[model samples]
Target: MTFYTYGYLTTHHNTWQYARIGLLIALLVVFIGLFVHYLRNRWNVKYKDLSIITGVLLLLVLGLQINSLVSLQSATKQSGEISATVQQAAKHLKVSPSSLSINSTSVSDNLLIKSSQGYYRLDYNTDGSAFILEKVTLENPKIKLVKE
Candidate 1:
């Protein structure tokens, strides 16, 4: 898996970064609590047992932290894809994304569609006046702009 660092917090929209940081803080608290408890009840448990317990707990927390990071990455990728699709649609329509209303059932012959749940298969005519939206699962969908 490729890993890229999103500087500070903006790259992740402060979502994943906050979660991962929270987990790290939790892990630190757990470790400190265990150490303090051991100090206060020195006669209750053996050193070897305490060591093993601490090791196991640390491993569990580390696993959870890793899972949280992975989930954040997946969410970020999905959002990025949506943003790219919106940009592509704007380019084809020659209008801002805010001005376009897209529906699955809406057929088009001139628009380049980028769908979150569909593959990228774009078709453009030689004259650049018309095109068909072809998806792997969806049948031939076409779009034509209404000229003023």
Candidate 2:
């Protein structure tokens, strides 16, 4: 809810918006309630083997989900930590927010912002610091900007 609210307050750039994770959490809560009831002998179970298989599968799915979620959250947090850096870079470059574009570098702790001048790679290691690098983008490689 807070994430959604924050997105609403800021920009809705994330298309997924993590709705799948929310749905998975709701399903997990319901499953846990039913499983608890079954364990307490309050729920009727006609297919014990099927239930066991389903529980195991759910656990596997949950484990995979946890792993992915942790990685994604860390990446998101790392990028998020440099939001102010991006804004300041934009102001320094005299670029408007609409024209400024920000991206993250997985290879390093850097937040990259592309502008007409070049790329501004912000490095905030608990210190006020940033740097820029120039790159000549060719229009012939439009696909490169989109995807590989």
Candidate 3:
């Protein structure tokens, strides 16, 4: 899946971020409480089992936090790359990037930009390190590309 889709899956907005962190903290508190109770009732078999379960849960929460951090980093990087590419393409077309609307599919590496001048599609390389103009459909016949 693309970074955009993955990010959406994990978090939709700032509120979700706060909510997720809050939930994680609550889980940590619960685990700590369970562990302390287990220690106070060390002789009970049930407390021993509960303590082990709490330990496992703590590990799971730690893993989830790590994964969330990685995902956020990746999403930020991918967003920057996409913005840069769009700006470069807009410059080439002699238009403001803000004037163009982007349309991308989750399964496709290509991105489509629609502007008043025409429709342009950009296709990325297999490794996604670079992209090139794949196609253009101009709205005006008077507009022409100058050969350099």
Candidate 2, residue 54: Cα displacement in angstroms equals 0.6
Q: Which stretches of candidate 2 lie over 4 Å from their true place?
A: 1-46, 102-113, 117-128, 132-148
- The residue pairs in collision within model 2 are none
State, as a TM-score between 0 and 1, how close model 3 is to the true structure.
0.59
Which stretches in model 3 have alpha-carbon errors above 4 Å? 1-20, 105-109, 123-135, 138-148
Number of clashes in model 2? 0
Which of the two, 1 or 3, has more lDDT?
3
Candidate 1 lDDT over 1-148, as tens digits, reads 1111112111336455676677667766766776777788888676447656766777776787788778767766754544454456557646554443333222234323433444334565776444454655546745442211
| Model 1: per-residue Cα lDDT at residue 48 | 44
lDDT of 3 at 118: 66
Give the per-residue lDDT digits (tens) of candidate 2, residues 14-127.
Answer: 444366566567666766766776777744684444456556767776776788777777766655544455556667777764455555423245445556576555555454
lDDT score at residue 45, model 3, on the 0-100 scale? 68
Predictions in order: lDDT = 0.51, 0.52, 0.62
Top-TM-score candidate index: 3
Model 2: lowest-lDDT 10 consecutive positions: 1-10
Sequence-dependent TM-score of model 1: 0.44
lDDT of 3 by residue, 46-83 (tens): 86777677778778877877788787777666655666
